[model samples]
Target: MKTKLSLFFIAIISYSCSVNQNKTKQSDLPIIGTWELISATTKEKDSTFSTFNPKLKMIKIINPTHFSFFQHDLTMGKGPNPTFAAGAGKYTLVNDTYTEYLEYFIHREWENNKFEFKISIQNDTLTQQGVEKVEKLGVDRIITERYKRVKN
Candidate 1:
């Protein structure tokens, strides 16, 4: 009788632990969704300027392990200022910090680089800001971007 009681208690404790381990916290989940860019700005040295044109549309999709972004002109790349840009790669999120690996890009020189940013989401809006610096490309600037979540 004593042996059976001890085994039963052990099994109950193990089951409880497994159940708790399967649950994920809510804060760890808000970043996984489709988002549309509302505005973007870049600051370099003494100059700050807007990088997002009102005529262009940009969307970014972030999953549990990866993220991708694409932007194009509203005129279907046929207007006076045709533009298209896209990049994608894996990412890691720790608290409010997000890091992305640029694995795919039209400009090959920008690939294989790691970019880290601080992100914050309030209601349906998200803001990301960080420094993007590439010595080979002579690029060093701070970029701030705002996005709204896409609803189904």
Candidate 2:
């Protein structure tokens, strides 16, 4: 009887530990899902705000350790000024601060750059804003982007 009791207790402890471990891993990821970009704005060095393209559509997919984004014109690439952009990289999120290490991009000059942004989540919306300064690329601006979570 004692041996059976011991085995049962051991099984209970093992199950409890596994459940707690799963919860901890899930809690660590607050931004694991698909998000669609709704709007964006860029503030140049002169403190002028430039609205992003209203007709363009973009989506950013984030997993446990990596993120990727794809953007293009809504005209199915048939517009007079067709556009498409995509990039993917690993990222880290510590509380409200998120940092992305750009690993792959069509624009080679923008690769291997670290971009950090402050992020916030409200309801189903996520907003991130930070400075984007790459001297070699001649890009210096503060960009703010708002995204809505894409529900599956």
Candidate 3:
């Protein structure tokens, strides 16, 4: 009986450690690089997807526990003075959910908002999708962005 109880305890401890290791390993696998935004799409209420051809180019960089994303329009003063449209903050990735806490943004109202996205990676492509409700934009929709991993 003593030997059986010891074996059971060892199995339990080992299983618990493996679970934690998996979480850590999985989080360390993807999203640790600079990604350039390839495309952005929004899904309407009727289940139709509309692509937003952004005037600015967007780039995102993710570290272990922090991330920064920024966009700059290269157009030389065509509309609204093509300039900076960027934000950055800390991020947490658990399982496949990516949550970003806005620490800095051009619009003050956007700061401190917790933005969550469902993330996936394949080969050199990264995809993120999430439903966003922006009262200022007067629209609530699902946004999906595809990014290509930038070669360092």
Question: What residue pairs are clashing in model 1?
Answer: none
Tell me the number of clashing residue pairs for each predicted model. Answer: 0, 0, 0
Q: Per-model C-alpha lDDT, please?
A: 0.92, 0.88, 0.83
Q: How well is each residue in 1-152 modelled by candidate 2, as lDDT tens digits?
A: 99999999999999999989776232243688899988888989667665667798889999988999999999999989999999999988877888899999989899999999999898899999998888997898989999999998
Q: List the residue pairs that clash in candidate 2.
A: none
lDDT of 3 by residue, 1-152 (tens): 99999999999999999988777434544789999999888888778565745677889999887889888876855777767777889988888888889899898777877778999999999999997766776667889999999996
After superposition, the stretches of candidate 3 with alpha carbons farther than 4 Å from their true spots are: 1-28, 47-51, 76-80, 135-139
Judging by TM-score against the true structure, name the best candidate. Answer: 1
TM-score of 3: 0.73
Clashing pairs in 3: none
Decreasing TM-score order of the candidates = 1, 2, 3
State model 3's lDDT. 0.83
